[model samples]
Target: MPETVTPLGDGPGSEPGGTPGGTPQPPRGGRGRRTALIAAAVAVVAAVAVVGALGLGGGDGGTGAPPRSGSLVPVTRTTLTERTEVDGELGYGKEIPLPVRATGTVTWLPRPGAAAGRGDTLLRVDDRPVVLLYGALPMYRDLGLTAARPATPAESAPPPAGPGAPAKPSGTAAPRQSAPASPRQSAREVKGMDVLQFETNLAALGHTGFTVDETFTARTAEAVKRWQGSLGLPRTGRVGVGDVIYAGGRIRVGHAGVRVGSAAAENALTYTSTSRKVVVNASAADASWAVRGTAVRVTLPSGTTVKGVVASVGKQATAASEGGGKDGSEQGGAATVPVTVTIGDQRALGRLESGPVTVAYVGREVKDVLAVPVAALVALAEGGHGLETADGAFVAVRTGLFADGKVEVSGRGVREGLRVRIPE
Candidate 1:
């Protein structure tokens, strides 16, 4: 049976002045159950846990050495940590749905996992490409000339040929050739940051002829025409609603929801950032444990450890369901909160796209304290836990943080470097 509290008012037995160590007593009955602050590692935990004198030194009462077989382990002062590890998933962060603003049949789609950069075609609707532009604003209105004005005969006349091309027969009715000013240049123009966004893409695509500003000019329209022609679309100087879409930067296709023959509708595809990230579904009770911006460690599939930080914590809770359809549905599984983690180094993850990973969350920490291998702790005869001195004395100790293979200990008699007996 577990030992009765000896006399160590703080724990079991103790001599005067609060120092543990009264008289040793052999276990009086069968082994009893006791909750131990033991580590979960197989190498650290023993098959059977013994208590009292029989489990420790096996001596009568006061002795200079153990009466039975054992080894001496000294108490050491060190820092201990409380850590909790949970399963995590590796991926390209969350997917953002892309709305198809054009009205046409989906004619083409890039393969999933393909990446699209600024000014690149994300999808082709009715054979017209819906190009991707870099910007925070979405394409909600026409950003170029709304309509082109009718041209006069003089304005319609062509300019003189360049030096490389044959001269227009010495201008023999070259119609007094002269470059006509763009008609829309004098008319009102579309204005806003959206205009600047399109112009930015236009300049990146090498179709620059206009300044990058918030207002779309006739030159901007000309640039748009050139860009459209390169994509095999009609050279309409005006950009239509289905002409393009905008995002922050390069994105990878996550999934294609529209088929080549299907009618194009909203949410035509999904895209995610090009970088790899980690997602963890933590237990709901761990909300406080996984605070935002908390630093953590992740173990990759190759056993390589990488540093990570908690990028975001979700407030909503979700849980898996247990199937019991007809008979009667049962309660759902434990609720969990979603957490996102970011890794700074791309080379560390290598070419891994998605897989399972382990995340370690640091909890409480105890500094500069006396501790010993958890295996050395013994249940007191009366109640509580204590450690055995190498000299065959029982020192009732109050336990603190438990981590690694050691447990923090403190008591009147417990001191650093003090030898404790470990049953072989």
Candidate 2:
């Protein structure tokens, strides 16, 4: 009895007597997987707690390290301001019109596309020795000698005494007043009297229908009235200031008109004004940048450089064209004042009409402004000004006019003459 022991289960390879081909088992695979998952979760929590304690999680985790001090490379900067904007147009000296000489039909007008300059011949007329008839009067005369007229002693008077009064001299002649102008003396006197000579020549030319005088008189008035009547214009009885007349047939030339042409009864001549050759328009707003006498370096569409001097600046605003997209979006605003720049080369001007060009204006510059490297700024985690200091400290700076890899900065906390560090 003492040695006998009951067998509770199957031993080794033998199955339990009461069961048929069955055995008890443990959940080993499931327990191993669960244990591994719990260990991984604990490890993650421990790492996060360590980082928070070390202040490596930023302020969000109520733990952040103090900013470190570092060295910075000091640099100076300038503030550039835009002054004025202006529009410019191109023109050539050849644009001036030339009148036809001798009246036959303008045998040849300069070819449509041909260019000409101040001295270039524009139109040629038929052959005819334009019968040159002197005007009843000319505007100038070469007086052989200076003339003097006898003056009454009473008329020669001394100047009144005053701060600028002349002191009496031993032999100084008394100043004399000019005599009142009379028609008779004026007509006879030829001392530097161009108007009188002009009349004399006209009289000699057999154009006696008019009398010459500086002042338009009844005779000249009658002549003008007659001419205007013949020309079918209102008989205003006044000769236009610069009007001209010829023999063969009558042709009228306006003031400053008719460079090489003549009025012959049966000839047709070209007419042109002899004033300025070209005109340009540009903007007042941009005028500040486009100063007078500025040497403008212009780059044309073909990559040619044309030198020009800014001649005139507009005082007021003017219309201008601005850059725009096909969809009507604008690239920039248009200039208000139109500035005019005169180009010296007539050939260069002729080639620049309506051509693409780039113009740069250098205005006033500001120097010695506090500046920082552009790369030093970091988008802040707190949504505010973000710039890194040389000591690795975070800072906020007010900045302006970013150019040439630097920005102008100024603020209450920022100061000049202070050594600061820039982080690498």
Candidate 3:
């Protein structure tokens, strides 16, 4: 059984041993009131002391201090655009390695930074000049002449002396003109898309007669002979395997890999399209912002700002090595996707070569919306969140999009120019 407890202030109709209630004698009116007043005063004093000890009173300089009042910030309506800046490179876009088809000692090379157009001489191998042509098909076989019967001396001779032909001057023998030696012919006979490339190049160079096709016909041989003759080469009606380099367009030599005496090999030079462009490697997370056709701002090294548009975005991501580690390994690396941006105003770049640049990608936007500092929001004891009014009253609010240190807010009492407190 639990022990019986008695209250400190218990006073009642008395019973034997204070076990039961009975009619109790009443004290003098004045003294009874005095005792009651003194007990009440003591209880009040003890309550104050306990509150102070627990640091729950406003008078305490600790956690018990009065609520702090924060400064007010006015809500405003404006247009907000999410923008991100990333590092980029300004140049002629990606570098394409030029493969050499002919193998020999590098006899001569175009000067660095030179621009070579279709049908222009790009370099020389063993004293044989390799020409640059505009085409996607690579040269795979030697272009040569088809064997044909030699012209008879009578057919080659100037009109046979006819009975009525003008008498030759005395001592002036008819100049003998031997038909040009049969154009040189190659043993390696080939026909494919490479032949079509040759025909296209011949046509582009103003030599036309044969149809542009995969077959190497006698007409193509004749055209080749004409082209060779124009170039002051032996009109052999033949082209060697290393006669031409096929490219997409005019190529600007960015770098040379072979020297005067180096053996000609693949990737003898690196070149790019003449058009300038900007390339940016962006994190995969930001790939969505690099959609093609999106306008952007490019900050050049000279501090010039030019408008540009997204040209292309890579579909795949790749690891990009950043800083070098102590053990000579990649450090702080991340996967990135390539994005190409084309400048709208090409002249603005001036004579700037390849260099570091900055590109800004504009993202989502919110317009004509009421927004407040993100710090203005406060949690309420009653649940949910609210903003403190100028008069220290808490008004509940609902939040929407959050961006740029500001958040969209709405509530019954929220309005434009309404000041809301922000924590310092």
Residue-by-residue lDDT tens digits, candidate 3, 304-404: 88999998999888887875223333323767888999987778999997898988777678899888988988765445667766654556778887878
lDDT of 2 by residue, 1-424 (tens): 5796546445555455522234545444889889999999999877764543333434422333234445565545445443322223343222322222333433333334443332133344442122223333332223211234655666655635898877779798966767776643443333334445444544554446754665444565455456445445567653332233222222222222323344322223333222212223433333455568876656555767667677666676655455522233332344465455666764764434454355545554556687766654445445544454443344455776665566667655555543444544
Question: Of 1 and 3, which scores higher on TM-score?
Answer: 1
Q: In model 3, what are the clashing residue pairs, if there are any? A: 13-22
Each candidate's clash count: 12, 32, 1
* By TM-score: ranked, best first: 1, 3, 2
Looking at model 2, report the run of 10 residues with the lowest lDDT sum. Answer: 246-255
- The lDDT per prediction is 0.78, 0.46, 0.76
Model 1 agreement with the true structure over 6-110: per-residue lDDT tens digits: 545355555343645555444444233222223444324232233345334432232333334578899999999888777789999888888679898998989
- Candidate 3 TM-score, C-alpha based: 0.57
Candidate 3 residue 148 C-alpha distance from true site, Å = 9.6
Q: Highest lDDT, which number?
A: 1
- Report the C-alpha displacement of residue 45, candidate 1, in angstroms: 30
